[model samples]
Target: MTFKEAAYFILKREKRPMTAREIVEIALKEKLIKTSSKSPDRDLAIQIYDDIRLNGENSPFVKVGRGLFGLREFYEQKREETVGEVQHLIRRLEETQYRSNSPSEFEEVLKEAFSFLGFETELKGEPGNTDVVLKAKIGRDESYTVNVDGKTSRSGKISDVQIDWLSLEDHREKTKANFIVVVGPDFSKGNVEKRAQKSGVVLLKVKDLIELLKEHARYPFNLLELKRLFETPGNADYVVEEIIRSHRDRTNFLENLKLIVEEMENLQSLLGYFSVDSLVARTELGPQMIKSVIDLLNSPLIKAVEEVSEGKYVLVIPKRELSKLFGRLASACEQEKEQKEQDDVKNKLVKNELTKDELIKYLSRTERVPTVLREILLPLCLKHGVVSREMIKEELVVRKMAQNLGQAGLVLSTVSKAIGENELLESIISYDKLKPWKKDNFRLKEEYKEMVHAVIEELKGKEQPKTDLKNRLVEYLSRTERVPTVLREILFPLCLKYDVVSREMVKKELVLRKMAKDLGQAGLVLSTVSAVIGRDELLGAIIMYDKPKPWKKDNFRLKEEYKGLVQEVIEELKEIKGNLQHGT
Candidate 1:
């Protein structure tokens, strides 16, 4: 038989707790087993200890005392009886309200309780200060000190004012102790409990301490173990339970989901919609267990699946979709984290202004102008540009300019000079000013009207075919100014189909051509057409002068001068299509 089996048989036969040496000697005398080791008793003891430690409560041998072993059932019965006796002692102590006792007498009782738990106590506190200072040997070379402040009241309940006398922080600073305990008859209010938690002060009622002392008598705890209770004062038990629950949740739910996904053919197959009942049937897990697994699987870290409808879920495993969501979240988090870093860099730039080359490199890497000082200094460092410090200052003063000629002239001149010198400029256009111009349908000053009329007259005199003329005009306009591309692509086609285009005509064309997928896209196309027509000098000349009524079916029409040119272009396009169809 194995050493484990022999030990178990010996323990059962003895019918009582026995030391390893006694068990080994009795087994050898009875000729139950044989071993050649010089220290047979020690080997047997090590074997028995290994079994009990490995199996825990399920082990055949139970540890009755230091180096003593007995049958499991027998030891359990004795431990239960001891615990019962300790509980009874606690109840008896609780019935005798010790609040009426003198302060000194109560201090003595507390010291005795600590002594029973193997701590050495001293009356180091003054009459009006803490009552006792405790020192305990936690290890062979390590020691811990704790300060205990005692508060006693004639009434059974102790008020918050009385509990405040503990002053945990003051005692900790004065004594430099590892922990502080405040023992009182009872806490009076709920707020006192909250204060104790925040202060890290262990509030032990007189009855509670008596119960702890009684428990120590039954099952003594080591100094290191007792120190843990003092170190984490209030709700330590609840904290430990929560930690254990979190660990269990990760292991059981998250790990199981990973395993389940691994066994599938592909994650995409799971994207098929599934109800809770269907999921339970497919995974072969209990309904409640499956629900918990689903909750954990839906988190951002996993994001393996998401609920699509009521009581239905689908896998969202596409990396593109997940990356978009993660990108926004990550960008926000990075901005918040880097704000302080940016501030530090800004301070350094202000203190030791960078050289021209260093500033260029810094600006290349960073996205925004670091500060107003940097903006004002930038124009001075450039070798060639009309944007002087005064010009930049002027631009800053007029914050919003829909048709501010001075700002516009400054922007154009600076850009022209910068290009001539082959110098890089950050941005020529002010986006804030440009936004209002676009929103107002590109309203321009009266100076621009003559320019628009001249372009219209030039188009009317063109001798080229209308298709070629239209293409040339579009190309020239795009090169000279910012022209919206959608207007050229979608609006020109509709103008060819109908001599004049209406809102309904545009929407129908968009749907038939599949240029837009929904109302939002259609609305965007219309807004682009409006902005482009309002901005282009030639188109503005045609549409602004021939403005149709708001409720008219054909609300947009080419002016009389441009109508013949558009018709010829449509005819030329039709001829090209006919030739392509006939393979000419």
Candidate 2:
């Protein structure tokens, strides 16, 4: 490798500032290249150093001095460097560009990079004093504003304070969503940490930024996590414990993880959705205790939960899913508590099993994903078929109630009767211990069974695999079998109003699909209509399709209604495409 390439490799791997002599010694010990103190190649190394220090935009090597080189861009402008002078320069530059009526190469490159990151950005006004404003869409009603400061690197001098210095709170308020990343090689980890702590800001050093571009482009760098890591004097331990150690100690953690796996095997047969959470709650533990026991559900374990949803979660011996793993862990915990009373050896074994070090290592090495619990819920829809998001929410309430009861362990007659009544929210769940509503089949009132059946039949009919777009859609609409009532009310009308054309077609299609399914190896050709019409729209249309207040409804229906207004989105797309087609 060239000296520059060798330097980049060493620094990137070391991930710390190092002196030139230190780097040379290590490189020589490893026999990485043919070099000598007396050789002329030492002159070549000097030239390599100059190449990196200059032309930084084109160089992969960022020189942080004292012979250190990193692969990152390490410079950004200070905010106050140019209010009047810079503003004037910006205006003049803008005027020159307007006279030419063309974007300069630098402006084009900057614009492209910003656009790639989902920004609507503009270079307005002028040169040294010009402003770069970026508009970013956050969510429905939130848009973020970014102001890019313009400055250049200076060897040893820091920028001077200007018209106003931002107070810690003010700085935090102003740059809450924005970042003050030190984008050059010379930035120190200690400096980055100090600024971040004082302002509750996120500081991405040059090397980290380069690594981010290479690896986690889509994964938003958690500003909050970074702030916490940098702000608190010792919070770095959280990063080490939560991320680094979890990776380093994977082997030992995985062994304890096996305990959870065993628990799942034992619990899967006896549980449904209620097992995982119920087992956790049964320890009489609060959130902190649960977090402590699980080493705060490290990122790797979170990703593992996602694997279960994706069908890649390690399958245990027949009928034992990964959810059982949590159950098994809880069982281990319980078993440990019990054994503590009788077997000292067993107690020590448990103590040594899942130490903080091992847990951290395992989690760090594993994949990182979000909303693992939510992902786990997705698989349930496949098994239960008709559990709508609404029904899932309702089930959660019941599950939570069940968990509370399970934790109590004593079945007081009054509380037992309350549990029997089945009045609870769907979100209150521990899926493993979830009890089926025992009063009637499918939780449908007896009088609504016929209506439910009609809806199911309508859904079944739409399952035909016809090529006619309209017919296939109608078939899909009518064919959605095992649909919960909340979904049914929304879907049935949309099918009836938009696709069915007549009730006879619905009946014929429904019966035909059901009969086809009854025959061995038959499959209905159905597509997801709601895929085209979103969940929000489907939910909203259902209310218009039927009249009763939903069995279990949430006020978030307002959000759903807003989302369902995708029909209005047609215009926005049309406007853009039309403008593009006309070369506007």
Candidate 3:
């Protein structure tokens, strides 16, 4: 192994900081690393030094003291050092909150604050516009804008200023914003409060905004949670405080996680394995709390526990290893969060450099695909390699995804921005001249077709062999003895949309080699449908006994309110396995 890799193993196993010489000695003694040099310790130290020097904060090795090194993974977990910019910005905001000789200066700081919280901010320079407009986009479809009226007061209270409560709504309407708020150092009682309440405007104090900044700088970045800031028309402090309470609850969960993991480690020695309910009973704790802790242990970063039975779990890793993982949870989470944000900026900067595999992977994963592309366009693309631009609008209308074509176009535009350049967009789809960015006949590039077809099959409920199974086997064995889960999932969604679906319709849908030509397995298919919809109800479904003596059902009808259950089943069946998850 390399010097750095060996050092990492040693540091993680030892769970403590060590000098380079000590690490080298251990590596050599255990044969974790090989080196023929007389001064192997000095060589390892030089390699680590060079790594830290080059990568700086991103290095795997961090200097703890004179010649002492530790894995950066478990180093100081607090985000205080990294949140320097936020700290400085908050200081400037606090200084200017009360009284500002220069309104633009305060506006500039406010803009920085908003931008820091992941909003696109613009100082409305025009006379009629609000002081600032802040826009936030949630995913591809939903977006909201905030018209912020910045008030500066000589008396450190907004009552000193001529606050226009009347134009707030007009300003929101003019700016096409979802919400409008008045931001100041503080507001005097009576008139200011009365006017804001009457205008249905949110009175946001600088201190509350500062509180949000402080919270953002902490371990849990809650910028998205702060959406409640615009949701209610009142003091925004309540929203910020509510978010803080959530973080506090998360803290409690973390403590519970410690208790659960440590207790599970002890119990594994005594009981071998335990279920969530068993753990709850043994500890005399709530099942929900134990289950929630189990969820955390099963997270991607910390896979300390694995389910041995249906609900019973066993500790997968040793207690020391688990402890080592959660030791630096705060810093590790912060680093990962920061890395993703940086990667997003990097993705946008690239001009449609997505590969064929990447395109397929993006569309196949629900999180990666925009809602329009996933729910509307891609489904049609699966049927036709080249779906027309109008087809997308039509599908959106049919599905009620958008109110009008104009809104559909906005949704498409958001998709365009997400997918990147027009060159890339047009390469995939035939485009119209007017809104050429995302509008066009959606088509797959020739290179993307083969892999995309495979993904299309996967989306169409093509199941894999046993190991790719996730409750499919157990559910299938117990619930429907003969019918396959995939066959049922395909028909389930279709059943929800229509009152009466027949065997002939299912046969037509499976025109491909998906089903056999002869109706040998027809009974199994009918049995699967009946098993889901209620077999007792299937007795009524039988129209009559034919002259041949066999009973036949004419149509498939999902009893009312089964739509939600049907959709859930379909989603569970289509849970993508293998490479689709986080690009593997």
Candidate 4:
């Protein structure tokens, strides 16, 4: 294993923090890590430090002090104990002679305190500037620099005017340090505590620093934790505790979702079409908590809830319908295979004189031919009469078949042979220097079109009557209850008059002129229809052309299947209009 993996394994096994040197020593002795670096110990140390710096609290290693490390949980517990001990020392020193020192002596005492607390101290001697600069590691991932200004008073109270010129903000602007601390006898006048709060400046009592120095002298402590106590707002212990609580809450939420899914096959089925309030009450969950859980279960992949009405839902499983679909697909595959075998025999009989019917049969039997290609080739042959080999290649590339010219040529060569063998195309010109061979002028024979039309009618006889687009729209509107009653009355007549409706028509006629509410309710109604009946199916029912330029003044007309339903809605609207005129 590498140094990082080896160090993590050892730390996890020991259940304690180990310094880089100690970790390397143990890993080498136990044959845990394989490395050829001459300075393996230094390499390991650098790796551990980088991991801690990059991953922060998520890192397995936590810095205990300068050059000391431990497991994260152990470090957290030890940190609290150290901070509490320092707080006690601060209280003790507040009542001593430590507060009655001169300014220079006070600076010396603060310097000593920081030095003992694992900080590298530098005294900055200049007029109207910070007194001392202290650098310390905050955690495995963080290091910080702080500027300290010393203030002394024999009365045990330092006035705000003495330190007003040395605001944390100005000092930070000049020095670009992470934090600024003011070490003084005490800030007891001019609302110093409130000032400190507003400016984010750390206020340290002279006695507090002396006590911390004395405590460190007696017993080593984690200076990082002490730094956090001074820098972090509010109780640092509570902040750390909340971090742990949040992590636990996240883990529990995920586990709860997994357990709930296993216990309830369809959670919404318990109470069909219920609201968010009912879910919370039934599950005994926190009022704000059930929404996220319900949303997770309602995702499209899970399909846990079917929205039967707005703000109300029911559970449904599509397994039975899915099974039926699979069965139909399997039957279709068998039919395609049988049809292919029959076409092979038919092709053998008319190999030289291929009719349009035979060509359609060949196309229908061919698997994986892109729909766009079929649409392009069939129309061009029927209209243009003649098509060149080069033209075919160009069209194929334009349709994104192959990436470039060379690849398109390769694909076309393969497809050309298939077309020629089926007798749908005949070569008229031989290959030469100027151009490649060309195919004869082609058109779909009348007899062949008649034969295909007959087949379509036979299939239509076996098919069931499809659901009408207008009826689907009405069902969706009824369920959502989103459309205003007056607007609904206007929309029925508009759809009937046009036999279809576009977004522009709905916006101008129904929303702007009739409703006059300055709302985009028409778009919302169309979106609901799209969602309920699928965007593709709804467009297919209303759009006149297969390849529609919707942005180019296109007029959508109802398909033959849906025209009858449009007429029905139109009749209903006429009756309503008659009643209104008669004052019934």
Highest-TM-score candidate:
3
In candidate 1, what are the lDDT values of residues 236-263, reduced to their tens digit? 4443344334445544664465544442
lDDT for each residue of candidate 2 in 130-184, tens digit (9 for 90 to 100): 2345566656464555443322233421222310124333433554534322222
The estimated TM-scores of all candidates read: 0.26, 0.21, 0.43, 0.26
Q: Please give the lDDT score at residue 43 for candidate 3.
A: 62
lDDT agreement with native, every candidate = 0.54, 0.36, 0.63, 0.54
Q: After superposition, how far is residue 496 of candidate 2 from its true place, in Å?
A: 74
163-273 per-residue lDDT for model 3 (tens digits):
876677788788888887888888888777777766778888988888877766664444466667777776776777887778776666665666677778778888899
- Give me the overall lDDT of model 4: 0.54
In the predicted model 1, the residue pairs found to clash are 467-569
Which ranges in model 4 have alpha carbons more than 4 Å from their true place?
A: 1-14, 26-38, 46-186, 189-269, 272-274, 282-308, 313-584
Cα error, residue 457 of model 4, in Å, equals 98
Once fitted onto the true fold, the runs of candidate 3 whose alpha carbons sit more than 4 angstroms away are: 1-78, 123-127, 140-142, 221-224, 277-285, 296-304, 319-584
Give the higher-lDDT candidate: 2 or 4.
4
Name the 10 consecutive residues with the lowest summed lDDT in model 1.
Answer: 428-437
Candidate numbers, best lDDT first, in rank order? 3, 1, 4, 2
Instruction: Return the TM-score for candidate 2, rounded to 2 decimals.
Output: 0.21
Better of 1 and 3 by lDDT: 3
Model 1, global lDDT? 0.54
